[model samples]
Target: MSANIENFPGTPLSQADFDEGKILTTHWKPKLEYGWDAGVAISRYLAELKNGRLIGIKCNRCRRTVVPPRVVCEWCWEPMEAWVYLEDTGTVNTFSICYIRWDATRAKEPQIPAVIEIDGASRGAGILHLLDEVNADDVTIGMKVQAVWKPAEERSGSITDIKYFRPT
Candidate 1:
């Protein structure tokens, strides 16, 4: 087969064409709605959170307990054995002080986000949550912290049930 490079058709556009609105375009605004069903493991986890407790699943095969309970052990690929109650207390594995809000606006008080390694869970297995009641300058890895839970009446079966973690 012979190539016909010279027969190619269509005009190349320049930046000025788009900038000056030479090209035709359509605009759209879509309204969307959605819902999520937290399955077995997470449903149980959230229920425990609402009741002012932290729960995880234990993998008897690997002898590791994981928070935000999973149905199976990520490492051993075995079914998780039982639900374990984890302490709300943990150590700061890492942290960050943010000057902006989730909406991209400036914040008067910086938010402290951290990975907390829960006491009863396997090392390096933890949750990402906000920190409070401590100076940003004083926040450090290995710092001991405890969950500051919302009042029982305010608990809502969500991670936010624990308002934040703070230095213990």
Candidate 2:
């Protein structure tokens, strides 16, 4: 198939006419700084996670409990009622067996990623995390799992507080 290629109007450089010594290339190292506010819900959620506890919020209007405790309910558009403690053990709603790492690198074994529906949380209130301590072929929907948290002292007030989820 013939293809029409849009070439930038420029004099083409040929091997015979191009000289390595005539071209100047400078290397640049980029430096950047960034920060963000976690906001009320996420900040409290992270703090609770750092302390080895899971907390969520209840919406009176919608009659639903949500994880990562939000100040306002997404469904009913009202302020959430109160905070609620949640169990670490949960069920895997959906999952994927991946053969690549987050950094675009390959892996010898497949990694299992799943959406865990925390016990005592509302429907559709699942958290995304990796699965461990099980074979890739054994992972299935509705599988029971529990959070394997890092030591409290080593907790960094982030989702990484939980090392990974393992079968119960």
Candidate 3:
């Protein structure tokens, strides 16, 4: 059996059609729901955060430890060997002082965000998080800092469990 195909030109609607309610339309409100799995590495990492500890994955091949752990070593392309608990201390590798909130509203005080190189991890492996408890001008590369965790009862298994990093 053969099927027939045809191309048809569209007829433009006129103002009279709209006025007469000839066009058909309906309102719709969709409900969207979903769940996310952080996978093996990140799940363990986040769990450790809630416990007030930092964890990293160690790659035996490259002898590199990475924070916010990954299942594979980025440098050697090998499977990570084991989990390593790291000190909550780190050094500020780089930073920014923003006067605007994440929503783009003006902020009363500047938000200082920085990439902190975990002391026990590889030289450059770091996490991006906010810095607090010090003047914006006082923040600098190589500044020693420590994670200020939320009270144990207030912690949830998330990065926010570590309230922020502050100069030690």
**Tens digit per residue, CA lDDT, model 3, 72-155:** 987899999689999999999999999998788999988899999998999999999999999998888999999999998998
How well does candidate 2 match the true structure in TM-score terms? 0.80
- Counting clashing residue pairs in each candidate, in order, gives 0, 0, 0
- Using TM-score as the measure, the top candidate is 1
RMSD of each: 4.9, 4.6, 8.0
Q: Per-residue alpha-carbon lDDT of model 2 for 94-143, expressed as tens digits? A: 99999898898998889889999999998779999999999988999999
lDDT values, one for every candidate: 0.93, 0.90, 0.92
Ranking by TM-score: 1, 2, 3
Candidate 2: list runs displaced more than 4 Å.
Answer: 1-32
Give me the candidate number with maximum lDDT: 1
* Ranking of all predicted structures according to lDDT, beginning with the best and ending with the worst: 1, 3, 2
